[model samples]
Each structure stands twice: as C-alpha cells, then as structure tokens.
Target: MNGMWTFLALMMMISAQLQAQFDRSPWSFGLLGGMQRTHFTGTFQSLPGLYNCCKGFDGSSTSMDPFFGGSIRYAITASFGLDMQVEYVQSRGELSAVNTIGNALSFNGSGFDIVEAQSAFMMSWTIPSLGFTPSLAWKPFESGFGIRGGFTLRLQSNGEATGREELIQPKGVVFSDTKSTIRNDRKVNFTPTSLVYGPIIGLCYDMKLSESFTLTPEISYMHILNQLIEFSNSDESLSMSALRAGIMLSYTAFTPARLVEIPITPLPIIEIDTNKPYIPKRLKAKLAAFSVNEQSKEENIVNIVIEEYSSLTMTPLLNFVFFEEGEDKIPARYARLDATDTPMFDIDFIHTPNHVETYLHILNIIGKRMIEKPASIITLTGCNADIQKEKGDMALSMRRAESVKAYLEKVWNVSSNRITIKNRNLPEKHANTQTIMGAQENRRVEITSNEPYIISPIITLDTVRTMNPPIVRFRPQVETDSVSTWQLIAGQQDKELRRFTGEEKVPAFIDWHIGEEMSEGLATDSAIVYAFKARTSLQDSAEIQGMIPIEQVTLHKKKINRVQDREVNTFSLVLFDVRSSEITEGNAQIIEFIKGFVKPNSNISITGFTDRLGDADANQRLAQERADATAKALQVKNKAIVLGKGNSALYDERYPEGRLYTRTVDVIVDTRIDN
Candidate 1:
C-alpha cells in the first residue's frame, strides 16, 4: 500500500536526524493520539466463492478515524530500550450501490408470460468498528525514535446491511413505465459481539518535553485478520487493514540511571565551631598569610604540622602590648603592663595583666601543637624591642626567652628537653630597627625549628641586625597561634584566687605595709595586692581575659580590731555619660552615699563598669578611668581601691535602659571596722 511506503519513508528520513537530544532515563510513560485510514477485505460466506461488495480494498471501502492512548518505555542501556503502547484505533465504513438495468421481453416466439423484469435496485452496508490495541516496541539506536508492533483485539459493535429492489412497468412497455422501489430501513448489519484479532505496526519518534514527560509522533499500520460480518441468511465477512500516520503526545516518568557530573573543588579544612573559643577569621588570615597573589600558580599555604611547631618558640604574629604613656614598673597598683611580640620576661611584662594574658594564649597554642605531636621540641629565641638600649637589653631579652621556656615546662608540663631557649642580644646581630613599626619587630622573640618547617614558620630575627655577620644568622620561628561573668558581692566580684607560683591555696590579699607614718592619722587599713594566675592544658594556649575576674580590692581586712558589728551599705553610681570616664559636677550627690556609710577606717571599694560598646580594650580603659575619678572625687582619706570591670551582662546593650544600667559603678562600704 502507498501508506506502507510512506511509513517506511518517514522512518528513513528521521532515523538520520541529529540525535542531539535530551538524555533518556531508565523508565518513561505518556499519552498518545492521531488518525488512520482502514483498508477492509472479506468475502460472502453465503456464496462460499464470491467476494462481498465492500470486501475488497478500494476508494469506497477505506475511512479515516481517530486514534488515541498512552505508552510506556524502559531504557536498558545507553542506546537500547523497550516500549509499549495501548491506544484507541477505529474506522467506520459504508458501501452503497444504486443501478438502473434494462429489462427486455423478446416476444417473437414466447407468449405474454415471457416479459416480467425489474430495472432498479439499491443496497448499502455500514461497518463501524471500535478497537482497543496493545503494542511492543524497541529502539536500536541512542535516540527517541523507535518502531513498535503488536495485536489489536477489536470488538466490532455497530454494523448493518440493507437492500431494495424496484420495478418499472409502463402503461405500454415504453411510454409510461411506473417506477417502484421496495425500501428497507435497517439494511446492512454485523454481529453485535465478535472478537477480531489483528496486527499493528508503527514508527514512532519519542520526543522529550522535560524530565518527566515525552511526546511521540508515529506512522502506524494494522490489518484486522478476522472476518466480521453477521447478516441473517448470509454468512459474509469483512477483513480490514489500516494505514495510519499519527502524532501522539506523551509524558514519561523518566528517571536516568546516570546523571551528568559536575566537577567540584573541596575547601581546605580548618576547624571551626561556634561554642568553642575559635581562631577568629582575622587570625586565620594572618596565619594563612601569603606572599604571593591568589592568581599565582604557587601554593602559598604552608602545611600546619605539630612536629615542626613544637620544637620552636613561636613569636606571636601580634604586636606587643605597649606600656601606658608615662609610668612603668609593670603596674605600681597591681602591675602596669607593656606589650611585646617577644616572650614574657621575668623582669617586666609578667606583672602586666594584659601581657600575661597574651603570653598565656600564645603558649597555649604552642603547647597545643606540641601536645598533638608529643615527640616534638620547641626552640625559643628571645629579643628585646629596644635595639637602642645601651644596658640590660640582652639581659632583658634573655629573661623573656627563659620565662617562656620555663612556662612550657612548668605550666603546660611540656618536657624542658622539648624546648630550647636562645638569647639574641648582640647589637650587631639584633638592631632596634629604630622605626616605630620596626621597633615592635625587635621587641618580639623570633622562633626557629629543629625539625622541618611547616605553616611557613615565620622566619626573621627578633632584632634586626645593624650589620650582617657571616658567622651569625637570624633564624625562622614558626609562631602558631569571652563571656564575662562578674557578680559583685561587695565592691569586688568574688572570685576563686588563682596561684601564680605555687600550688597552695593562695591568700586573698597581702598587706601593703605602708606603715603608721604614711597613714596621715586616717587610721586606714593598708591595701595589699595579690598576684593571681590560673594555668590549664591547652591545644593552643587560650585564656579568655574575662573568664577569670579581677576586683577593685581582693585584700582581706587586717582584723587587728575585731568589731563584732559589721554594717554594710550598697550604692549605685549612674553619673557618667556614654564613652566618658569622668564624673560630672552635678552628680556630686553620688558622693553622699560614701560619706554617710564610711567609718574613718572603712576600706572603700569603687568599681566602674561599661556597656558592651566599641573595642573591648578601649571600653575597659574607660571603665578604669571612671572608677579612679570617682574615688578622687569622694576624697576618701582611708585606703580606697578603684577598679574598672569592663562590660557586664547587668545591662543589655540592645536598648538605652539596659545600657544605662551597665554604665554605672557599684559601691559597698562596711562601717564596722575599727579605726
């Protein structure tokens, strides 16, 4: 049939198409619809040998009908797959015949009984067949196009057959012939129920609409192989064939067994945790300092290794905490502090609370490295920042270096064998580098490795040399590097006293021993300051500054006079403005609380606190100044201790009211002590 030729032609054209397409997955399914024409074939069983009127394939026997249904597909591999479909394919047929035939009476020999003839007849057959078909399909290439074929079980339901004959009798045989036709209303018929088996074949192109859907266009053909006619008194059959080209739209639940891969680069792993004290991002940047641009081909990050870091005194990459503007002796009060990139000296910065904190943190980090690799050693090379020092510079640098070495051994319990300290004090070897920026560089202790370098072990001398010597060289040191809880019972936050040099339970305070002459007849208890320090194990030596609290006065009363009655009074001072450490003249009324509660011998304690604002260091300094000025304003002749306990949770900085609460000093006085 021409239809078969067209189907084959379509197959040939599309099979060579650009297979550039969406990937087909393992399974898919969708709907289908299209149209087809049927070609019928059958014979009359009544005659047993003759073909029926509409039995043969011709112009009148073929009809077009709708086709619709759904399909499913399974992909076995990249290029091979199987598919199946169920669809509605049906055709209706009608054949009619009308004719006028000449009837002659040849009466030359025969009498009047010879001439009875009919000249007109009419007949029709209506065949409407509905079918439910199923199919199996496959594709040999890695494309959406494929071929499918299977059986159609057709139930021919509505069919009819009818015929009529007419006679024309003229008044005289030719002039007035009466034309008559016998009419039949219900003519052609088919068996109400009959199973018709047939084969169907199609060329379908499976097109993907999206991940889960597909569309298919097909050219399909089928032949009904069974006879399908049931007329009373007539055993006739109609075998039908169809040539159809249909476009079916389908949706498939297609899931691919493999997906296109995307390349990814893993980020370098560094430990980060919210709950734990962590290396801040700034510190990480400093630790990962690169001398080269990011676009460069060279790898800039030095691997962090325990063995390399454990054997060297790592100078903190941080600048030294410098002494305050004028006075120095660590602190004349608790101990004034100074900053240095160098290790702590037994001589100076050990007394500085800030310097002590910094030193502890650095050591904790170093100790952490050493702890990770127990078979490691650290070398400490200490140098003073002041290259201009004519005297005691070398001694000062050596003392600082030795202090760090001793700390690792004593506090962290690292074996002294794992650490070696060296003094680099020669002016020729270590210069002041005299510039402000360079001066801090000299103040810092430099570190070197007995093992290999990792983490780009910072390589430089503690002091820059005035002149280079062939015999002496500056070595590299790998420096590997807060919730406040303060509840004031009196003027001080009651804290557990920590030991600086001993294992015993340290006393709260030791007497100042300023003696009777210095008392100025005020009869005040001399204040004594106690050195406090707490040591603990660390991966990197870490101490949150606020974790351990300090107070305005920690010294216990002398108890020389045991007055049984101890009168206690508490007052809140809210006189200061934001970022200001001065008490205003209008707020002099706050001093009245002090005057009312104090005995001449009362050990007055004044502590100033601030809201959590700005940098922590600046906030703390402001607090201290405020407390001192408040004490000066009170004009207390007795021994008075002023403390600045930075920020307190007593106030939430989120609102003005909470911040006002924090911007106050708390005072507690006991009038019961004997003067």
Candidate 2:
C-alpha cells in the first residue's frame, strides 16, 4: 500500500511538469461500465465452540463482478475538476476450509466403529451494493493523463451466506460418508453492515475523439475501512477491497465564453449664456524693423546696396519629409500635385526666397527630376519616432513610405520598379529623441537617389543684389488674450512688398530678407510703411502702422561716383545632430571654402543662431560657442565679426526642417571690386 501511494505521488510530479494543451469544457457527462475485483479478508467461524471442522478458519475470498455507472464532472479550472459517479456493483466470493480432528465413528447398524477422518465446510455469499463516489480530479499534463482521489460510499442490499458441511471416512471403515447442508441460500442469521465507506485513488487518460467528445480509460483501487460482517460469537470480522478498471465516454455540455470590456466616455455638459451680449476682447498691435547694416545707427532705418551680377543660386535640398506622430498619410502642408497638374509644375517658376517654402514642393521636384533622369533610381526609407504612440511602429512607417511611393507612381507616372520602399523604427542619422521637436524630426521618410542631380542642390541663375542691411528684422507685438488671426504687411506706397500672417500668438521677431524684388521696390521709396492688424475670435480688431526709413542709392548717382560693384557670398553650416560647438569634417570643408572667398578688402561676418528650444541664456551661450569655434576654424588674417543670436526665428519654427536650418552659423563675405 505504501508503494502504491509512492507510485501515485511520482506520477503527479511528472504530470505537473507538462503544460496543458487541450481546451477542456466546464461540464461533461460520461457513462462508465467496468469490472471490479473484490478481495475479502478476515478470520471467521461458522460455529464457535462446535466441531473443529469449522473452527479457527482463515476467511479469504476473491471475486470479479461487473459494474455500470454514470458520472458528471465540472471543471473548476483548466487543470482542476469535481467529479461525481454512481454505480451498481456486486461482491461475490466463496470461503472454504478443511481440517481433521479426533476420529469419530459414524452411527451404523454394524458393530464396527467407523472412524471419521476429515471434516470440511464451504461457504459462498453475494452482496449487491449501490456505490457513490465524489472525487477531485487534476489534469496537469498536455498528454491527457490525470489523477483523481476520493472516498466511496456503498449501501448494501439484502445479502446471504450459505455453507455445506461434509464428513470423510477411511477406506477400511465401512461407515458411510455423511454430507449435509448446514446453511441454505437464504438470508444469513447475522445482519451485515448496511453502509460501507473507503478511500479510492484512480488514474485516467483522456483521448479526445472529437470536438465535443472524449474517451477516458481509468483504473482505481478502493480499500474498505470498515468490516462488512462480524461474527456474533467471536471477535472476528470480514472486510473487502476492490480494484476497478473501466472506460468512460464523455460529452461536453458547454464551455463558458470570455467577455471583453470596453470603456465608454460620458458626454460633456455645456451651458448657454443667453443673458449677456458676447463682448470681444481688446486687441493691440506693434511693429518695428531692426537694421542689419553697420552703417545705419538707427533701428528703424536700413541702408540698401543693389549690385548687378549674374549669379547662380544653389539651394541645398533637405531630403526628408516629416510626419506627425502616429500618422501614416502625408500632411496637408506638403503640396500634392495630380497627374493633370504635373505638366504645369515647374521648379524654375518657384522663386520663393524662403527655402522652406520651396521644400514644400519636394515631391513635385523629385517627380520632375525622375522624368528628366530616367535612369536614376531612388529609395524611400520610412522611420517612426520610436516613442509614445509611434514606438516600434514599423507597419506605420512602411505605410508612410508606401504613401509617398503611391503618390509618385500615380501622379508623376514614375514606374514602380524605379522606387524602393523600406521602413525602420528610426532613421540612421536621427535628431535627439528625448525632446518633442527631436522626436517629430525623427518621424520622417528619407529620400536617397543613385543619381547625384536627382537630389542635388537646385541651381538657378538670376541677377543678384547685395543689401547694406542684409536682414530686415520685424518686431511685432500683439496685446490680446487670444489671437484668432494676425497679419503684418510691409508695403511701399500702394504695393504690398511683403506680408507675414499667423494664427497663433505673434512671435517676438520676424526677419525678412532683402531679395531682388523687394530691393527693387525699396530703392524708389525713402521709407517703407508696415501695417499690423490683429483680431480676436469675437471679431474685436486692432490695426497699427509703422515706418522704417530706407537709405537708398540712386542708379544715376552711382554712375557719377563710379561706385565699385560689391559681390556678396553667403555660406551656411547646419548642425543637425547636437547642440555642441565641435565642428565636423564637412563643416571644416565649408569653413575652408568661406576662407577662400575672403579677400583682403572683404568684410567677413559670422552669425551663429539657435532654434527656439531651451533657455534663452543657455542658447545664447551655445550660439556664441558655436560661432567662436567656426571663427577659429577659418583662421583668417582679418578680424571677423561673430555674433550669437539666440532663439531668433531665422526660419519658420513650426516645421522640423525649419528648426534644423535655424541651428546654423552663416558666413557672409562682402567684397568690393576695384575697376
């Protein structure tokens, strides 16, 4: 018995090591029918102090009986279950004993005494019972092997024990052998135990036959703890044990379904103000322009220098189109051209002085380039921000690249075979990922081409003019709680020379370049008036006017004085990755180029600028560090003017590329010709 328990414990440990593989139902009904082998044990005597034939007999019997039952199992979990089974079982066994005592003569008419040799007694009984078993079942393995343990309750029906006594004589003795039935097959005189209980341990293996059906083979051993019958005359009793083997076929009734929870947001409450009129907020605007010329001492007056020269303007193109976080489609800010509009799209016609505006037509520009260079192939590598909603979103990145690819294929008639699309978490050369602007810049698609001109700088020849005050800085201030719309218009007489508009709060400073068109218009006017208008959402409006004096040199006066024609050259070194002052090899090469353009009479000005990020003081320090580094790298003989402009919006700060372009040190060299 100890060995049996040891074996059972070992099986449990092995089963626990395996993983559950089958999906079991909660409720199952099964029919079980099998054979039970009962072993009976005890010491019994038919008659206590009577003949030695039935005295001091070791009682033992073994019988096999068929039992049929039904069981119901409820699975509490994937591995645990409760089982109940009821069956009708029968226990049948026979006990026989033979012994020889003192010889006895059989009563006969003859004078000879016959010696009785051996006496024997044979007994057989049958007990029918109704058995109920409730057990806890555990299935710990994916192999469908399980174990169950419980107690069995049996209620016995009317049962009886019958016995026959026999006497055997020697051959020499003429006494006839005597045989008589001592007990009939009727009910026994002593009452049997009506109720029996014992512990039962079983093992079973489940074989899944179908989706809702399973067949299991089981074997169990039960030992009755209490005696079945006790001899009234002696201190001896009879007990029985059973080993049952059977198979059960079960059908699943139903399995519970898992429920998913969804959260619902409640609607917000709104109140209407019908008792009072809507009063608009008061709005006020201020406007001023700072001179960039060293000759002009006043802030409102700017000296202009117009020179005639055929120059090639090479605008280096940024090969990335940025996207919003968690978005795959192209933003509306980028200009999209249809197939019908492709013929009318001309890169040469785009003459905006702002390079960012020209960058808005990047797709059209690429398409036009592809049309011109048919052998060129390009790859679009999409990237995600790798944080927040966009973290490790490779699918979204691929979709963004595909979006660009689809636009090119559909609108530009570019062959799909020429374009290759790829995706990754972030670009190879990405910006700082810790900041919001940095993450925004990282979420973009990079365009690379095998042909150089396809992505090279856009070059155009135009009549270039140099201004004494190269930059006209506009300072606009608006006093309003909320600004719905604002516009600053710089005009010359009846014509609008330049206009800047915004929906958000007005920036502290807006810089306007003295381009060819603006310089021509400003040459005729002594002063340029700028009008500032602002309004709130409630239609409360304010307008202000400001004038900047212009020191203009007329064409006839320049011819009389034989004024020397001065040429201006500007070079920019953009720092994209970090805010450090360390100059890279590429920046060193640009510095060498700027050094080559510097003549003895050339006035060199190096201005360092930073984006609208971080503290103003810190930016100022960083900008100064960057400018000093560039000046040291130039190693020029003449002293150069170096200034650090901190967070002064040189370009539109709303775009990532604009922010990147703002973090730069620009070298402008103005040299006069002696003719």
Which RMSD values do the candidates have, in order? 38.0, 28.3
Model 2 pairs in collision: none
lDDT per residue (tens digit) for residues 102-125 in model 1: 554535545643454433333345
Per-structure clash totals for the candidates = 45, 0
Task: Tell me the TM-score of each prediction against the true structure.
Answer: 0.28, 0.44
Tens digits of per-residue lDDT for model 2 on 176-229?
A: 342332322233533567899999999999999966889999999999999887
Q: Worst ten-residue run, lDDT, model 1?
A: 304-313
Runs with alpha carbons beyond 4 Å of true place in candidate 2: 1-314, 459-461, 464-518, 522-563, 584-596
Whole-model Cα lDDT per candidate? 0.48, 0.78
C-alpha-based local distance difference test score of model 1: 0.48
| Candidate 2 worst ten-residue window by lDDT | 178-187
Q: How far is 579's C-alpha from truth in model 1 (Å)?
A: 99
